[model samples]
Target chain A: MDRRDFLRLGSAAFTTATFFPQLSFAGTLPHGWLNGFKDNQGRYGVAYIDQKLQAEVLFHTPLRLHGIYKHPTRDLIVAPARRPDTELYVFDVTTKSIKVITADEGRHFYGHGQFNQDGTLYFTTENAYDEERGMVGVYDVTQGFKRIAEWSSGGIGPHQMRLYKNRLIIANGGILTHPDTGRATLNMDDMAPNLTYIDITTGQITQQFSLSEDLQHLSIRHIDVDDNGIVYMGLQDQVKNRRDLPLVWKTNGDTLDMMDEPVEGWEIFNGYIGSVSTNTHGLCVASPRGGCAHIWDQTGTTYIKQKDVCGVSKNADGSFILTSGEGIVRDLDGQNQRHALHFDNHCQAV
Target chain B: MKRFFLFSFLLLSPIAVQAAPSMQEMSLKVTEEFILPAYDDFAKQAHAQSELWGETCDAEKLKPAFQKTSDAWAKVQHINFGPITSLLRRDRLYHWPERRNSISKSINKSLADKDPASLDLDKFASTSVALQGLPALERLLYSDGLLDGDFACKLGHTIALNIEKIATGTDKDWQEALVNIKEGIAHPIYFESMDEVAIRFFTEMLAGFQMITDQKIALPLSSSLKKANGKRAEGWRSNRSTRYIQQNSLALMAMAKPFMSFMPDDVEKQVVAQFTVFARAANALPLSIKDGVKDEEGRAKIKKFLDETRTTRNLLVQTFTKHLGLTVGFNSLDGD
Candidate 1:
């Protein structure tokens, strides 16, 4: 089939098999998972996988998305375009429609964001590219998600933030890039990555923690917090030929410490952790380059081998749902479900 | 008798499925034919240079030796994983794209100190990586009057020895890695499967092309002729920047040959033809990369060559990923 026909068939399948049923809105919204994905025909979109594993493509766009976020108390989901791109898609579950959120002039989304407890305000990690600054863009959810205000992220490339009490914890990935160069890090020789926490109300920096000088090249990219208020980070080493560097770190709001390396060594992850998620059991970090998911708990570190695995989230029962670019969704029970969609970097259990 | 028969049957069984055998063959060929020999040659040339520097620190005699060692490095430098990645050996061998005058500053610091104890092999290895690599030697030899002093000559010899040590260690590590691959042992630092090995080689090949196009060519070429910076070119001091591209293209071709069997005949032919075109164009470039980027015609020629390199890389990415069924993960390939 031609490319158009293939995409048409995909949309038809989506409408018939998944979209129609979801549009009824008869009972309470079903529990589902949200992730950005690229279909077999190379179309980028966000998919909502229902409990039965039926994925409904809320919308497709030309921009590739990275992190998928769901509204706190509403049927709204947002998929931010990956860095160097200018658009973010906000999908309304009840209406089955999507609204485009454009980054302000001279700014672009870093593909991650979070909603406040009441969902009145939304915050996104963004890059003020022209100034080489990281920004936390606050949106007025009550005003049609308009760009309300922006705060300095306390470092360069801020990615993957989490809300803890009144603080917005940001992983300031120190690599500096301009859209002109298209994600090429300009300051690799001296990049200073830090974990910065800002007050949600005032956008003032509450605290910031940085790695030692030797480990300055480790970009603090992804963050997660457990029930104990301990924060975890997934790092991407900016330097090449660094095999022994740590990829996961944890903080107790005071000091940042590297986690113990898996018995197999850090080289297996190829120095990149695509996603980090925490559960009641413990922490799970996905390494897409390494094609493995590592779990750390009281039982020590163990890994599940799956090719191209990246997006990982905690299921309701505390078990992890792992997705991959190879279009496989795997659970801790060893069950594998195949799909025609290539899952992107981050997923959320909505 | 029945137990013995069952054991024999199990031993004779072929565990690899259809794609696995091709991947296994590709990995084995790449390891045995290309990676091992390339590194072995580098180690040999480095050791020879070190011995020559020890015998006589004359610039004339050592310059030829340095070029030989550098060329040998150009062949195997694309293999960035496994043993070469350990101990910062790769950067210690040739720290290029030296930012903020790091190499110059480090070299001057060492010269000012002039302490013999610091030149000891182990102590030197622990020193700044910039001073322990080929670039330091290049600066010492190619720059006028820099090596005339006794301490500077000794330092050059020490850098040669350091390169030799790193090259030898990397070669030995690759040998052990090959053994692990052959025995099907799950090496934590290297490969747990033949598929993984193939992917590593493929990734390196793509990265090699990218390095050539982006760093080797475009960095020096810059945007326009007026903005061209010759010193930005790698190996600009030795005037072998263009030669490095040719050598890298040839080495990548050698590494890519084993995977051709896994692709269709047309794809195999296209890849071969494209590599041949790119290699010839790269080899035929008359001026050094340092000189070539200075003028409009030269810049045009280099730009055409860069386009060809990118085309070749895209072809390889399309064909290799498709035929090998390798999902170059979106997140893994370019994750934010």
Candidate 2:
């Protein structure tokens, strides 16, 4: 009937299902809980569920969200709009209130952002659509999320960037699609999608690596970092001639190694991968299109299939918690939890 | 306080009940009118095709039945989520948008080895799905390699029979599923509420448009007309890309009809007009969508049609649903 009543209903619905087996782990649990959107009835907003699976808070958004970023030093969460969207919502988890912000003129969110250390600055990948460029918007978080500067993401259609120390590792999905044409990749044959490492302070591209000539069609879209600081990237292959191309790659600052999977195993992915995350064991990648999630060990080898799952994030001890669009959540061992909500493609531990 | 709350709920109950019947009627009519009948037609045509294949292994005899079955499939392919998804029946029916010619490769290997298992209808169930669907049948019937008395024709006959079996079985499944859905709606579990059922229907319809827009057209069109690639079109192997999309638009238009009463009258007209424009442009395209992509005028026409279909999809997804007082919370097509 009202905010308190709806919250009570949500909490009772979520926490009453306590019959699930205890999810065993080997190390200290993550400090904070999981945060993602609780989408239902075509209405969506941020949702926070604690370690005990207690529903903490829920807030509504007028537009769809992409990834969630926790403030470096506060109880705030920042979620950007899905690409071609011009809005962003900053939710203060403590107060359960949100502040909406608009991207500057001629720019729109590429759906991901991360705060620099100490939460002083926020950087997001954006489309300089009119300029045919991929630019990163730098916000002075202390100055009320001010747009202080902009930098090239080092390629076109940049999506999913992360902070590695002081540098930014960006997966510049090379396919150029205009918001006007609506998600159609303007350049497939001649388009170049690359992974770039940039110096965040100066907005300079420190290093960039393009896929080999034969693998140019693989748009490196999502990325995650292993405990060892190696960046593992997942690709959505755009070429129709080949579906067996490797969909997972790992990088150590300079070079990229295409991880191998059995031909049949790769076929299960159907050439589209949605998200990637890393844990102590290895990297976890999701293919929502293929309805499969895969794991590759730290060596960047040894592929394993966990069928019919997606929306993966790491637990404190480095095991994976997976969610599905069907509203089921479970860990690697399959201790299941259910709620009346659709889990979007991204989830993370704050 | 409790007494007052109870009184208010009682006062509002009739109004809530009054809103549900129209939603129920819409869902029921769609299942009864469009979805069930299309799957039924698919089953009947597939059975006829199998019978023709059995009567004569001749491709000429089999071709007409094959096309009829394919057209039937296109009409109902929008049901990609429910009963047909069971046992990979949908993929087994037509593995278009195939990977690296796997269908041809699997078929070729089976034929080359003269795999006795290929002739066994039951054994074909466990075979790679690539060899089991309409695509395989189209290949065996229309490709030049198959002779009337050849082993490949025997395999083709077995596949045809298998497709018939799946189609018939799927139709039965749909009937049973509809029964369960109706029961669930009345009881509110298979779907949480009547609103959910309506939302699910709209979402599926939206998903159908997404498949046409993303996989069928945009994937091939790439960024521009100059860079078009026809190989990405669905049903490229059969050269039925445009035909397939035409059937899809027709089916989608039919689906929108029952929901028209729920929408503003002009919205209905606008939605239908858009579909009609796209369908005309789609049907008028040259022999194959791939070939169409190679010609400047043809590409322009195809692009215009795709843009129109996208607009129609947006209306159904955003405006139509909102007007119907439904919400689609999320679309898988809206990726990160």
Candidate 3:
């Protein structure tokens, strides 16, 4: 390399070095390195995926909202909130107004609530920070917030619940992992796993299941059900003492299941797969932190990723539309230009 | 050998401070640029997205899984650092558009010419450097004291510096840095074509990164993950290690780019289409597995007890059919 070549190489080396800065002292999670947040942003509000970002601020406080349920026919948006207050905010999108929904003064939630297929009744999972007393409350989908049903998660903390007809398929993410602290700080070894299938109207545990081993620490939090009766769920593992696990699993509500181990290439990126949805082809899991859509065979078989993909939604068109980490909504058909959106409140499709 | 080189460039001038006799040159240049401030209608949209993804985030508590991969690689960087570092550089740098494009174009060009030196990873070619001396400019721009002249500016400073550094590619060694930088950007670029998952997943992408060397990936993927069965659930399986394959496989594809003229259209369409479809499905996978599962067994004697409840999603038949229909073109199965 001559002088000009020297300048170019020197510049290149410097760029490489600066761009790929050495990980200094892994020192207990460099909060400094993490910035440029998408999919969700700005004050306390509810985020949803649409043609672009549609942010409607419910509360002015710092409490983080967890759930946003759309009224089946009405343009009403139901948003469940946590911390500071356990209030659920209801908004009429067409009118662009708001209302608050809640269970009681004592309970707040770590997850969300959903409307019935008819949009008459709604269900929200409440953690209450007390595992023994944790419950899922039912409210009037429309009028005055009426409390109907409240059930238990056994031991697992229920953050998300998917209503499969009468069967409320809930992901009881066993332990309560804090958002204030990072993932490396939870204990999973002593966890108790149980998947309770309750007939929403009856509130009876018809069928129960377990992983049968060392994964009790795995929190069954998010779930998706297809046209078939198959319940596709997702998990979050508790980091015990000083260790963490990023392995994902799948089963057709059976004890015998396939653990979708991270690809040999992704062991280190043992991604926390979040939110699962299945198309005609296979299942798609979001590694929110990893920023990629890890698509695996329906049986938890093969993991083929579109990498760094996030906030996926079945588009108005038959294909799926997902938000990229770069705040672009890319069509599955591979269109020339993505419908670029951002969270002016928070960007990207959520 | 771990080498360190630090050369500071002189961007500021001493003559400006020394030169006396200052003139009252208060001439103003006003440019009314199109301005739709973020605080306008975008705030609500931004907030809605955060809560929506956050509420929906954690399909599988992936941070634990994602962190595990990064943790292991961090431990191994003490040795060959090739694959691991390549992955780290990819994640850390690719987040920037210019850096990402530059890295991709450089790699693409290098692959075309087969000459790695064409990459331009300049440390100083940046927007951040121009903004550094903006304290004086700040007092002039916003007519003073009206905007946050402290913390936000500091944050802007950090973002600029970070992006510039990423643009320069100066933080890591340059042995195979070209390929490393390209792969770093490409992996995410491929996977993240859709939604920006939650924060926890980003950590996993970083952690799940594995070191793929030329010799190792020469074999590419061993067996279809679906093919592995009961006994396949052994040693390496449980660990759920993530890999960074497809560099050479992709490079090989890039080389065949021009030669693709000879092949039929469906063949080419099926190839890219299948890979992308596979990529989409792969992207949604692990998080589904991680969040889709639960350990209610309490981790003790829960293993001996078994529960079998079957609920199959029939739509999957179509997905599998699509997989079968597409020509994946993996060399692992030759006899067929």
Candidate 4:
């Protein structure tokens, strides 16, 4: 299809009316299917989470809004200040106003922004978008908007971040290369790419491992590490082969050694891994309809595909609040697949 | 030197601060969807379906038999990442409309067990199954999904299939299967290809199988494919596209030795076909060809075996097929 036609069709703005029937596809699941929420066939120009899906005009932005975190100390949702900066946005969920913090840092944003156990420190990654910019970073979430204890994206597209006590696992999905253009999406093939680790306090390069074979396409987008220290990242493999990219990798905490690697084209996508998080012992990653959600365990590696699912987050009651381009959730896991919280625009989550 | 140091320091600072080291083995979020008891379960079942074709006296029996096989293929789609798979993987397992899975399985089994010298009526009937469904790729592009491609998948298939007809046909018809395979193997050489059906479907399908097992990564062979390509320089491979090209090459290689070893006629011509398939697969490797590389070493070993088959015949075929089996790797039998 031509770009004009695609933009015309894809930019229709996600809507509940457009998606209500989609949720019925996986009707057996208590939480609605994620595929039901995605544009499914959209060309992926920009993505947004309409609070209208859950509420009316709560907060809105046009940064293609990747990662947004709920503030711990106050009523705020902290998303990347923008796609290209450490610019963190502190938006009030209650008041419906937003502040772009870290605006001074001109780095490109990926997603998955969060605070340390103390809630005082914030961590996230930004792509250099190639060497034109520096990669991702880890900063402190302060009373005044600021990015502290920052870092580079390593290669070109350093994406999300995970904080583990003295250590941090960066989900650096190299997303710079464009498939249609047939160029280095991340312009990282000239350099090495991998999960780079450093001791938070010492700021030393503890160790790094590269998805050496496929170059920069092994974008480590989102991450979740268990108590045992095994790390996982939602991968968007660069190439479009059944055998490469759009994968997930795992590593042991203590050794920082890789326990799992992405199967080239092993999953349903060749796109970005949006948001990945864990509740209790369970973990999930969004393939952006690269498609669906993979919920797995740390110890035995038990996994379940909440097929066509996304926005997997833990609710206050130990349940999940899954947001889709369509609005749906598996509030209690009973499998009704009901459309919850109606909306008129694209619906992601806070 | 001072200026370089300053540049490097500024460059390294954020990477040092913002980036957290990644774990070498990340437990993937979606691998759970792909856990299945087998990777080729549908293929296996399809093989079974192929065997049962026309065995019964009743047509009712025949339809159900085909339906059962078709059902398995349907399940495979639900498991596969995307709605459509490339013709190559599709070829590995046949699919028919009415009773595809079963009928294809019947053909494969009969062929696998058939002896040319003792061939019978049953063998011909079972092995006669054809590819049925939404027309092959060539038709899709020119007819439906595409507008501007030099050729689509079916055009390629038709060329190969016609070549086979010419080589193997009776004195008047002039049709043959081996000839078809050879030309098909060489087609890419003449054409500078553009796009291919992406592999997201493969990953998603594999992930679906993995889900049943709920494992970290979907397929065991993933590690091997990654490891094989890992050591090479990124260069042109930095582009995300090369994955499909690499897989296409590997799939062709798997067919190379079998085509050669199974050669029925002039040793020279048969060896030529075998070499062609092997070379095509190798040339398609995504990395720019390099000397003194490990890939070169492996290719050399396979090529040597292919060449040896010219004189040694059966020994080379066994050796090559064994190699193909090893290279493709294994998945759980359940499609997991």
Any runs in candidate 2 off by more than 4 Å, and if so which? Answer: A1-65, A68-109, A113-158, A163-181, A185-350, B1-23, B146-149, B185-197, B261-270, B284-287, B330-333
Tell the DockQ for candidate 2.
0.09
Per-residue alpha-carbon lDDT of candidate 1 for residues B1-336, written as tens digits (9 for 90 to 100): 232223224324543424523566677778888899999999999999999998997898889999999999999877778788888787777776666778888989989999999899999998988899998999998988888788998999999999999999999999988887787566776666777787888898887886776567656765557656888888888888888888898888988887776777787898899989988778766469898889878887886787788788888888787777654776677676
Could you give me the TM-score of model 3 versus the true structure? 0.43
lDDT of 4 at B172: 17
lDDT of 4 by residue, B1-336 (tens): 232223223323432222211111111111112212123443454444444431332333434433443344334333332222332233223321111233334433433443453233223223332322212211222233321222222222232232222212211111121132223322221111110111222233333322211110111111122222232321112221223223322332332323333334454365566546544543444333222123545444423422332233233333322321211111111100
lDDT of 1 at A102: 86
Model 1: DockQ vs. true structure:
0.23
Docking class of 1: acceptable
Q: Which is the better candidate, 1 or 4, if ranked by TM-score? A: 1
Task: Write down the lDDT of every candidate, Cα atoms only.
Answer: 0.80, 0.71, 0.36, 0.37
lDDT of 2 by residue, A68-168 (tens): 88887787778888778888777665554567789999888987998998899999999988788999999988888989999989999999998888889
- Candidates ranked by lDDT: 1, 2, 4, 3
Model 2 clashing residue pairs (backbone): A42-B328, A42-B329, A174-A193, A186-B223
Please compute and give the TM-score of the first chain of candidate 1 against the native first chain. Answer: 0.92
Which prediction has the highest lDDT against the true structure?
1
Tens-place lDDT digits, model 4, residues A8-30:
43344331011110111121212
Off by over 4 Å in 3: A1-41, A44-63, A82-85, A131-133, A177-187, A240-246, A259-269, A297-308, A316-318, A336-350, B1-336
Model 1 scores a C-alpha lDDT of: 0.80
In model 1, how large is the Cα lDDT of residue A97?
A: 64
